[model samples]
Target chain A: MQKNYWRSNLKILSILLSIWFIVSFGFGIIWSDSLDQLQIGGFKLGFWFAQQGSIYFFVILIFIYIYLMNRLDKKYKDKSEEKL
Target chain B: MDTQVLTYIFVGLSFALYIGIAIWSRASSTNEFYIAGKGVHPVANGMATAADWMSAASFISMAGLIAFLGKDGSVYLMGWTGGYVLLALLLAPYLRKFGQYTVPDFIGARYYSNAARLVAVICLIFVSFTYVAGQMRGVGIVFSRFLEVDINLGVIIGMCIVFFYAVLGGMKGITYTQVAQYCVLIFAYLVPAIFISILMTGNPIPQLGFGDTLVNSDVYLLDKLDKVTTELGFNAYTENTKSTIDIFCITAALMFGTAGLPHVIVRFFTVPRVSDARKSAGYALIFIAILYSTAPAVSAFARMNFIDSVQEVQYKEAPSWFKNWENIGLIAWKDKNNDELIQYSSGNALEGVKPDFNNGRGLSGERLVNNNSDLSNSNEVYIDRDIMVLANPEIAQLPGWVVALVAAGALAAALSTAAGLLLVISASISHDLLKKTFMTQITEKQELFYARCSAAVAIFIAGLFGIYPPGFVAQVVAFAFGLAAATIFPALLMGIFYKRLNKEGAIAGMLSGLVITSAYIINYKFINVHLNSADNWFLGISPEGFGFIGMIVNFFVAFSICYFFKKPPKSVDQMVDSIRNP
Candidate 1:
């Protein structure tokens, strides 16, 4: 159960990070036109996000990850009293 | 407000900010000076790394390179960014876990030999100095243009600013200052790009603007650029004229080389946990992408703006931007009487046009080139693409505040990267060479003092080089990349994965990499300055790409020699395991 919980958490974090990476680096810059076909909020979904939107998301991701990791470290304390 | 006045205000504000941060955050020890005391937050470290990674080349030149080279410029985009992937996956976490202060520290510990560390330090110094030289040149360019000072005075001023922060704040100072710099440089880069995108394609966002069809034109941005440049007697924008094999090798070398850059890798050491190291690389790229993706837009827009501005008039009518930029000496064209002439006659002769006073053209007569060199076509015009970013606001007639922001941005790019490179240079000299190698028992205070001394020395040399550069900024940075590609990268990769590779093999590989790569580069770039076709490079793999060939020689020679020699002893396996395991 604990292994499954940790594994699931890792997967979720990885996906979110991947999205963060793609929005800023990949889609925003590399494949921007493909995403630019769609519009969002007076902005092309791809290019706007690449320039401004993706960076805001990345900043948010880092803070969230840091908070989550702190909780995780506390909740999953080693049975033998190991502490970071 | 005039743009030049705004520029002074912008540059002044940025200087004050960096100096303030440097004063606030000072490093006290070898540990803090080298690696920020291993207490930095991942996000902050990410920002610092972003600032460090995005040099003047990335800030000022990359977009132009892309606009000019098209798909071929993908080598730079991929070669640079791809290194981070290698860093995140293959290098960063392991190096962080290993807990080394510098690259040479790892080399020394892993090999259990001073000789190996010495070799690593030599490579680190040579590579870093070349890189720093480029950054210094970038700083001088930014200063001279914005402040209207002599280039040497500009370099000296830049050296002073870098010294105040790097020497006083050390890594701690640089980290906080770079966060501020990231904000300035990124804003400077993105705002102009946004305007140009809006102007060209009616799309406010550049990344999408690039792909969307040109405003009222059916062609895509890339396709338009391709067509336009081809029409203008230039190579097709997207064709891969380089040999496929050379492309693959050179790109791979750059990837590995970037991954092994000690300055960039050292930034990861600041974050607390191994996991932060991984996340920081991702965030760094995200921050960098803001500029990187936008760069192509800037390049394309500027190129389109430039060609549009200059074509159709004749020798006397080139736009105001031409002469304005020529005043800065970045764009030089020889006129008659063998004098370097700035032309405004042709592009200015358009029926309904008024030029800005900032253009600096004389009122009546158009500036035309004399056929003094006796060439048939006296009307040829050439502009270096580096002027694109600096001249963007002027070309587009954007507000002066926007123009000022750009001056701050360019300096931020050069200074941040120079500080990062200085830390690496200092570490290699003070910690790696003096403290560890010769004077292990030296006081911590003395070591810190020496590190600061080294910073002052490196910055002085780098400033001098920047003022009177041995080569152009981008070209010199390429030499740094080539050195990294040849020496440290192959050694680091082999040391991790190939346990059987012994110290002797690594040293031999490094020496051969340096000797062979340096020889090839010198032969082509400098030694053959006499323009000897006989001394021309092999298979047209220019000096920049020759590092890739040198790497192959290093690897082949190391492996072959190792094949003949004894395997790494049992202790080597234990050392490799230490780096691999938590």
Candidate 2:
């Protein structure tokens, strides 16, 4: 059961980090020029991602991780309690 | 009250509050000193960490950097905050679970080697001092302007304030003081930004203000800036001037370096549980993002305000802020063409205009003196980048207290980070080097004594580094981040995940990464700086980006050496397993 929990934790981390990578590095810096052709409010899409979007995503990613991990911790605790 | 008097009042009050907190939370025991007795609330720790993490650079220099760099400045934006994601997801909880007082403590026990601990200490000290020197200098700059004091005297005053709280309170003192600093610095930063945003874009929120149309025009803020800067022969405000590869590497280095910085990582240790460590990191970033997101807007607003106020205006008719900054040797204007009007365009230096600094025949102590004695043609105005944030309120004509608040905020940012770094340096000396290795039999009282004494000595040296700074230290400071990314981050990350990794591999990995990254940076940035252009770069990689490559080298060397070594002993494997668990 502990092994399963660790596996699931890694899975969640990988998924979130991939999004993190794609937003800041991939869209923000690498493909920024292509996206700059498109505008959002006053900012180019790619420019906004670089300056603003990536940071928002990072904040959201952390909260989501907190929520998921708290659940995982509770689940693991209940399983061990039952075994005891 | 006048601005200077208001500044004195605000700064004086903040210092009193910090010293009071230091006394209130004074650490009496080793436990309290090192990790705040492991009782800090997660939210409070988060705020303190935010204060500790946002240094003088973030408070005073970053908006100016972004204002000038435009798209290129995104390197700092993404690089600095992105590391928190890595910290939260990868390292913080695991390190908290390990239950150690310092980064070296984790390294020493994880690999079970004194040598590994020693290497970690050296890296921590080197990175911490390089960073602290910059902060000391920042404090000096802010002091010189607000207090009308000499730069060196400003540094000395800043040093005394940091020493008071750091030696008395240790981690407990520094933590609570940092929380107070977080409030001061954030308030000082946001108030001006909100005011400027409303003035420029009719939007109170700086983030939205960046996107909204100008208050009196339909043109967007950024688009307008792009037009003005390009017309001045500067790169368009939002266009990328660097190669994508360079940006990628720089951003990567900063992210990894931010995650790997020892002082920041230590904040997670002050929290109660592994889960709280994760939560604390999230909260820390929220506090950080408040400033980070607001910075770009601040940059855009300041840039537009600057050009509108100065460009093409007669030097004689320039605003009082311009003349006031000029008196401080931060702003300069000469009618190089004898036209009496200031021209500020990139590459507009007059063909025969000579820069005259030693002659003392110009405003602000330096000027482009026209050789013909007729100011026929020369780029007549010089503006220091540091003045953008400092002069923002003045340029916008805000009230005196707001100007004073910015001064207090700059000091708060510098002092909090300096205190945190001083504690880390002291701990490395007393705890990591002395108590752990050489004098294991030392009494607890003696250990605390060593911590306090070492912190004083560290501050003294750090002050010297600030006052008589080496010519190359400012340039070399950037490499500190790369060095941390290369040496520390990989070791800590791999130590947690790879059970087969032995001490031999860890030490070898760290040494190789440090040497190679430092050599690459020195060779290009300092040793042969003339040959440092993109064409001469290795794979077009600037020294700033070398950390990313250095990290890859560390992983390869570590894993390859691990393959040849005997599998870790059962005990070492169990240590890894335990860290991986709760």
Report DockQ per prediction, comma-separated: 0.08, 0.86
Candidate 2 chain B: worst 10 consecutive residues by lDDT? B368-377
- Chain A (alone) TM-scores for all candidate structures: 0.64, 0.95
Q: How do the residues B255-338 of candidate 1 rate in per-residue lDDT, one tens digit apiece?
A: 678887889988988888877887887788778767766775676687777767765544456666666676664554444333
- The regions of model 2 sitting more than 4 angstroms off are B348-356, B362-378
Worst 10 residues of 1 chain B by lDDT: B348-357
Report the CAPRI category for model 1.
incorrect
Using TM-score as the measure, the top candidate is 2
In candidate 2, what are the lDDT values of residues B308-355, reduced to their tens digit? 888888776889888777666666666656566777776535343333
Clashing pairs in 2: B336-B375, B337-B375, B337-B376, B338-B375, B350-B378
